[model samples]
Target: MIEVSKDGGLLTLTLNRPEKANALTAAMLADLEAALAGPPPAALILTGVGKVFSAGADLEEMQAGLGRNPAWERVSAAIAAMPCPTIAALNGTLAGGAMGLALACDMRLAVTGAKFFYPVMRLGFLPQPSDPARLAALIGPARAKMILLAGARIEAEEAQAWGLIERICAPEALMTNAQALMVDALAAKAGHIAAIKALIG
Candidate 1:
């Protein structure tokens, strides 16, 4: 459900079940949490192997209720708690809870074709803790409300304009740009990164 690898100081976690659009399960979330809990890295990248970063939680399990799946929220919170800079490599569309997870990242570098939306209102669920604040911080309160309240499906360009994404590159160029962005960020000492993350978080 999740694959993790490290190259130099960069740790990359790829959501494995691409056939299912990388929809998250409890096992997958636990895998993510366990990976995050280990020794800190200079930078961490969370992405999906194929199209669709994540389709959010599994709807079949969600039948039990949104509260039944708290692992996703825990994983999102863990990303924020990390001492290093975290990047959400948005290779594809992000929706529902997946958007919350991306919002938790310190930076989001997305492919220009990627789309995003938070359908909490349509789904009858509230945004996770820290999500509203994070979204508001990036795009401001009005646009945040427009997304959360209106269930707007935002395009990559619009999202970039709103400051929801740091940059939009061609799909093939996404990782290259992401790596370049993280190079300087990861150059800082771990202690300095931790202190700054604490301040921002």
Candidate 2:
């Protein structure tokens, strides 16, 4: 579900189920919430192994839960509200609710080969509107509409050009650069970072 490793102040969380395109399960989401809530790691990096960052929720598991459960909301909110700086390393394509998870992060950096898409409407679903405010803030409302409402998939280069991604790197460089960025973040004054985040939020 998730592989968590800590080195100094950096916490790296990897989505482990590549066989399923890293689609998140309920148990996996629970573990993710617990990991985020248990401690205040100086910085957090969320990524995925193999190809896909995440394909979104495990539809089978989600259907089993009937989409009415409160636990998912609680866990998602906890991740969104984590105190430390959080980065999403889009190691590959991201879709559906996984895009929501990426949106929860404070910043995003995608691999050169990565792609971003929001296809909830294709599934006869609606995205969590609050989750995309970060995307709109990073890009703009008009572009956000093109991406979200139009269900358009954008390549990493275009995303970077649009200011949706902080950086774009080759596949092998994604985690390395993300770690470097986290190191830089951890070196900054924590109070100042918190203040800036608060002011911006």
Candidate 3:
């Protein structure tokens, strides 16, 4: 479940599984890989269609299949490999593997009530490989340690202050403003954006 839309240079991928809190599934991961496996768009925006960004991996499916882990890892890698700037529009909560997806993006915008959560400590599961290092680089060792070690779920305001998100928008203006920001950020500088993104990554 992914809804793809393109307007000018921005390609938006919306996770469309509200029924399951937009949980990340193997098929969804496949779709995401396919979407990113192309010449880069000027900007890519990832968001959820419903109220929650993602509840995490499809636990029920994982119960039936142990193969979901590698696919999920690839999803995060695909997001990171995009040559152009990428943004995560956090309409609601992001849990578990969803954190890696958002962290892989170049920028992140979250609505006021949105949150960031990971259960690595509580669930005793190893996080995606790149996640701990990237998160620590963004927020610092102590704060990142607090989050991953204690399973903290920080809300939007605190998340922004701690470098988890770039900005917090009111619910109604989230997507519109996110798109506008992407357009403004990448206008007439697609090559430069790609160059800098490559350098950074």
Candidate 4:
């Protein structure tokens, strides 16, 4: 499930199914895709409410071929194209297809205990189309290959060191830190925000 909240210029999209480790379903992916379909906000924070940001696609749904769903690419592409600054506030371990969502964000902030891994090789599924390039851009080809091809589970410290995550914070400080990081973006005019992001790209 997806929980959407807006406070003026800031939009926060939270993955809310704690019972399932916030595993994504087709309907959940549809909700995510729809939520991000409109005009961009000044800033956006993508996170989850449980110990695991997401366990990737739901097992049952994956078996039913949801892994091949185009919605995954659509959601990630929408995030990638956002004019506003986007951050992935990773509350816990990030795995499977869900890695695409974080990879699309402009920056990633993870909790100290969070782990990063995409086990597509082990699971026998290719990651969404844009994920590999985005991932390689952030952490480089060999490291990206380590996760995608060899299934290495990177700890938060290592993730930060390797440029996978920008910062590592205590679980309690995650949201506050994310908000702090957005202060400048939220204060700026929408056009200014977009222009700055474009310049950085």
**Predicted candidate 2, C-alpha RMSD:** 2.0
Stretches of model 4 off by over 4 angstroms after superposition = none
TM-score of each: 0.93, 0.89, 0.92, 0.98
- Candidate 2 Cα misplacement greater than 4 A, ranges: 65-72
Highest lDDT: which candidate? 4
Candidate 1 per-residue lDDT over residues 34-74, each given as its tens digit: 99888989999988878789888777767876445677678
User: Judged by lDDT against the true structure, how good is candidate 4?
Assistant: 0.93
- Candidate 4's TM-score reads 0.98
- Cα lDDT for residue 184, candidate 3: 61
Q: Please give the CA lDDT of all the candidate structures.
A: 0.86, 0.80, 0.84, 0.93
Residue 134, candidate 3: Cα error in Å is 1.2
lDDT, candidate 3, equals 0.84
